[model samples]
Target: MELVVARIGRAHGIKGEVTVEVRTDEPEVRLAPGAVLATDPPGTGPLTIETGRVHSGRLLLRFSGVADRSAAEALRNTLLIAEVDPQETPEDPEEYYDHQLIDLDVVTRDGTEVGRITEISHLPYQDLLVVARPGGGEVLIPFVHEIVPEIDLAEQRAVIDPPPGLLEEPPGVDGADGADGAEDGRR
Candidate 1:
C-alpha cells in the first residue's frame, strides 16, 4: 500500500525529460536520481529515475528507457508511488493520512453523533472535512484544532465542536425539494 508521491506531468524539453508534480513534503529527498517508482494505473515495468532536478518549481525527471519526447509524453498524468511498508508507524500523533480520516465517525463535544467523514477537501487555507449524515445534509467542517478537537484514527472517530451556525441548514433549503437543494448544501 505505497502512497502516491508524485504525478508525471507533460514533457519538459526535446530530451527524455518530463515534469513531475511532486506531492511529498520532502520532494528533493524523495524525487532523487535512481529512485525506483511504480506507476498507476500500473505500467508494464517499473520506472527508474535516471536523473531528477528542480526546474522553475516542478521536478524535471528522466526515467530509464524513456528517451524521447513521445516516450516521456506517454507517462503524462501517471501517478508515481514508492513501496512503503504498512508496518511503518507515524512519527507524530497528530499526523495521519487523508485515507485514514475517511469513514471516521464524527461527533460533537456533547457526544452527539453528527455524521461520518465522507470526503476531505484540500483548500488553500486549510483542509475541510465533509461529514455525511443520515437525514441531514453534509456538514463541511474545517480541519483545524479548534473545530476538530480530537481525532482517534485507531477508533475511526473524531470529536468536533464547530463554530456557531456552521452546521445549520441554509434558509429556505429543504432536502425533498430537488437536486438543487442537495447541490446548494454542498456550497
Candidate 2:
C-alpha cells in the first residue's frame, strides 16, 4: 500500500531545495533524510530525501542529484509515495490514514443508507469525507467525531450522525421548497 507522503512545491532557492506540502502524519519517518520514495507519473522518482526541515510551517527538502533550481522546479506537483504496511495504524487511534477511510459504507445511526466514502479531503482546519451518494451525487461530510461517530473497519462502514439539512436540500434555496408566493399566499 503506497501512501503519498508529500508533493513537491516550488523551488525555494537557486539550490535544489524545494518546498513540500506534507501529506503524511509520520513525516519524521516517511519524509526523513535518506528515505527513498516512489513518484507518481511512473518514472520521475525513486527520489531520496537528502535533507528535510520545517521553514515557516512548510516542509522543505532537498534530493540527491537534484542540485540546481531548475531541477527542483521541474519536480513541482510530483507526489512522493511511500510503501506502508496495511496492518500499521497510527499511534493515536483518532488519527487515520486516507486508505482506511475511503470506500467505507456511510449510513445513519438508524441504518438509513447515506453514501459511500470515495475520498478524504484534507484541509488546514479539518478533514472531509467525499461521499458518493446512491442517488448519483456527492456530499462532503465533515469528518469529525461528533458527526461521524463510528468507524467500523471490520464491517467496512462509517456511521454518521448528520445534522439537519446535511443530507437534505435546503428548504428555501432557489425556491426549492416550491412555495414561490409570499407567506400570506397572495402572490
Candidate 3:
C-alpha cells in the first residue's frame, strides 16, 4: 500500500531543509533518514531523506540531492508517499490505515443501509468517511468512535450511529412540513 507520510511545507533555510506537515502516525519509522519516498506529481521523486529534525512541534527534513532553499521551495505542497507491506499494521490496535477503511459498507447500528465508504478524508483535526449514499450523492461521516461505533473489517462493514438529521434532510424545509406550521405565509 502506498501511504502519504508528509507534505512538504515552506523552505526552512538556505540549506535545503524544509518543514513538513506529518501525516502518518509513525513518523519516526516512515520519515527517517535514508527513506526513499515516491512523489505524487509522478516524475518529481523518488526522493531520499538525507536528514531530519524536529523544531517547534513540526518535522523538518532535507532530501538527498536537494541542497538549497530554491530546490526545497519547488517541492512545496508535495506529498511524500511510502510503500508499505500490506501485512503490516499500525502499532496501535485502534489505529487504521486509510486503505483499510475505504470501500467498507456503511450501515446504521439498527441495520439501516447508509452507503459504502468511498474515501477517507484526513483532516488536521479529524478523519471523515466519505460515504457513497444508496440514494445517490454522498455524506461525510465523522470517523469518531461515538458516531462510528463499530468497524467490522472481517465483514467489510462500518456501523454508524449518526445524529438526527445527519443522514437525510431535516424536518420543515424544501416542502417538508413541520408537525406544526403557522397556518399560512401570513403567519
lDDT by residue (1-187, candidate 2, tens digit) is 9999889999998989999998876889999999989998658889999999898998999999999999999999999999999889989988888999889999999999999999888888988999999988788999999999999999999999999889985466567565677776867
1-187 per-residue lDDT for model 1 (tens digits): 6767788899988788999876654456557888888889796247988998778866799999999999999999999987766655456777666667889999999989899998877664788899998696798999999999899867879999988998888666754656455566764
Write the number of the candidate with greater TM-score, choosing between 2 and 3: 2
Lowest-sum lDDT 10-residue window in model 3: 178-187
Which scores greater on TM-score, model 1 or model 2?
2
In candidate 1, which residue pairs get closer than 3 Å at backbone N, Cα or C atoms, i.e. clash? none
Positional deviation of residue 21's Cα in model 1 after best superposition, in angstroms: 3.3
Model with the higher lDDT, candidate 1 or 2: 2
lDDT score for residue 24 of model 3: 81
Candidate 3: where is the Cα deviation over 4 Å? Answer: 170-187
User: What is the TM-score (0 to 1) of candidate 3?
Assistant: 0.83
Question: 1-187 in candidate 3: lDDT tens per residue?
Answer: 8989889999998999999998886889999999999998877799999999998888999999999999999999999999999778787878888788889999998999999999888787998899998877789999899999899889999999999878985556454574345656444
Supply the TM-score for candidate 1: 0.74
The runs of at least 3 residues in candidate 2 whose Cα sits more than 4 Å from the true structure, single-residue gaps closed, are 170-187
RMSD of each: 4.6, 4.4, 4.7
